[model samples]
Target: MMSALEADFGQTPSQTVGPYFAYGLTASQYGYDFDQPFDAVLALENARGERIRVEGRVIDGDGNVIGDALVEISQPDGEGRYPQTVDEARSSGFRGFGRCGTGTESGNRFVFHTVKPGAETSGEAPHINVIVTMRGLLLHTFTRIYFSDEAGANANDAVLQSVPADRRGTLIAERVAQDGAVRYRFDIRMQGDGETVFFDV
Candidate 1:
């Protein structure tokens, strides 16, 4: 009873791989007693550079917030250098990495508390690398967050420049100051209008 396609060797079926990330990766935030390797906070009191909050929600193609999304970010310290040893990270109070889940926060947003990153190279702009994982996705997507305040540096950034002129805005985070705190909003749109520009790598 095998058809031509099934008899020949049809492609394997794909499976959704997420909506279960919190139980394993963000257990602490989900009220699990397990120790999490990292959390939303990436900087301590002694951390150098300007401390800022990055907040945003992951929106689906239908424009609804994705509550079960897990977001991870990594970036160099303010001085554009990464800690090569545990001592350096402890002394600086900057771990250069963070992870957050949208399910715990109101409005289903992922917020990262850390210092603004500096340009790693002369021709590069200050940016935070982002990774997004959620349900229905077989593979996670990668993107970068560039600050709206860094106009000059962003203009010269090779990676940002490589993206098409119009689509570049999708990667820029808007700077906002409220209640005497600095925050940058960078929403990730998975599809449809204003879809974020995800890199192949």
Candidate 2:
């Protein structure tokens, strides 16, 4: 028998992230009736800015698509302003945040309907901040989606410049046009060659 003090002395085991994110944080995507705080649509039809779609899949080290991944994104409005209140968000029809689960869509892809954000500051480029949570990950990963067409801004972005030149491409979303819609493809590779550059924060 262990003493009371000894029982609590061992290090806690790390827990793997699981599909709970899809069933909980993104409950609606999985057909749950629970109220979803946010969905893939971040910008409504009335939202200001150039409408764009961000789409991608999460790939494992072996290149297999992870269908249970949960992706979240937050960004400012076109003029580089974020809504400060619920009324403002409702009036603008742009929440500036979104969440999606890969399993909900065909091809195990996650998509966000948003507008092209403007530079929030002189040192920063227009980019959408992303957080990924999936099975086997002990902690969520952080990354950014930089538009490939924003060449000048991207070239001057301090954060993008911090990443190595060869690896910076992983952070850029390729521009693509389909069915008269603008879409950006930014696949996230968890490991192996061409892995995405995840931030520690």
Candidate 3:
């Protein structure tokens, strides 16, 4: 579904939405052939001591696969509250969200890379959340995992409910899965498709 914002500016690149927002303005639903997605590549692994890993992959509107896309995943710190820090990161402009590095320890646990997510609406069963265990600077643990996301399923997600407002964009991710090596090139904020916006209730 093309967002109401994308419909406003017929055919031109934009950096500003209605008035104040100036990021992800030129966002378009998968117009034309979604077969050709922008370059994107990323992955995620659990920090839990189980064989759990969320193999995220990127997919086009037509269900095609996008490769070579770069993705950066971040969440709130322990207590699921990293509002101050994230604002600091985002304050540095694109540099904050653009810096590609390994995952960090937050929210009383660890979070790392996972594959991009498929175009599954929020109403499907628990997909794979590859759960892994990281100890020290070495491969201290490993395992697979299964997590859940339900646009039509649950009104509230545990991990998702831990974030604060305004800074809730931290929960967004274009993570998905596909056949071969895929990538994620979707821009997400605190609303609509592509952007995995969650609540703090």
lDDT by residue for model 2 (1-201), tens: 999977866433332354777668988889987889999998997898999999999999999999888999999999898999999999999998999999979999999999999889987889999999988777899999999999999999999999999999999999999999999999999999899999999
Cα displacement (angstroms), candidate 3, residue 140, comes to: 36
lDDT (10s digit) by residue, model 1, range 11-89: 2333224457745798999899879999999899998889999999999999999888889999988898877888998
What TM-score does candidate 1 get on C-alpha atoms?
0.91
lDDT of 3 at 7: 75
Residue 149, candidate 2: Cα error in Å is 0.4
For each candidate in turn, the TM-score is: 0.91, 0.91, 0.24
RMSD of each: 5.2, 6.0, 16.9
**lDDT tens digits, residues 140-170, model 3?**
1111122333343222544434445454333
